[model samples]
Target: MKNTEVLEERITAQGCTEHLSAVEDAIYVIGGKWKLKIIIVLQENGNIRFNELQRNIPGISARVLSNELKDLELNGFVKRVVHAEQTPVVVEYISTDYSRTLQPVIMALSNWGKTHKRNIREDAF
Candidate 1:
């Protein structure tokens, strides 16, 4: 079955469509591979310049990083500050308080990932 149909069935089975929809909305905002990584880095580093952000996230193209940052900013998870007074303008990305709400979710995902990896290794043996 298609993913949506599967999700619908799961929602129906669990009788928690509202919760599922909220999760879908959360995923829509921060579901991508780069979005969460960028948020985590920004949260850790406080404020980072464009090039510095790109360097912190290896393997992300400049274009993709730009797009992701825009999305995160639009979603209120990140703030883009530009300083034009300097001879060379400086732009920085910082995580917003809204992004801190995802801390529990991130921790849960991290713990689950570790458990999943251990389970997979055990199964492989």
Candidate 2:
């Protein structure tokens, strides 16, 4: 059987379409490493400039960040603003109303990760 067919069968067995859709949406948006990090940064800082975000997030190239931001903007999770000014003009990015909806989800994931890490460290003993 195909991968999607397997997934559909498993989803049906779970008996929760709502749960599956939520999981699917979460995966769709946070599938990439850069996307999750970018959302977290924007959540913490409110609005940030392009270079500032680049500096804050290590291992992300300008082109990669640009592409990620563009994707986020297209998906209604991020908004980009260009400042038209003389001498060293800037562009800033901020989370949108839709993005704010994910705040609780992000916090929950962060908390779970922290707890999991702590448990793993303890288990190493």
Q: Model 1, 19-58: lDDT tens per residue?
A: 8888999899999789999999999999899899999999
The 10-residue segment of model 2 with minimum total lDDT is 1-10
lDDT of each: 0.90, 0.86
How does candidate 1 score on lDDT? 0.90
Among these predictions, the greatest TM-score belongs to 1
List TM-scores for all candidates, in order: 0.86, 0.80
Off by over 4 Å in 2: 1-14, 85-88
Error of 2 at 43 (Å): 1.7
RMSD of each: 6.0, 7.0
lDDT of 2 by residue, 101-121 (tens): 988988998897997898888
Candidate 1 Cα misplacement greater than 4 A, ranges: 1-15
Instruction: Output the TM-score of candidate 1.
Output: 0.86
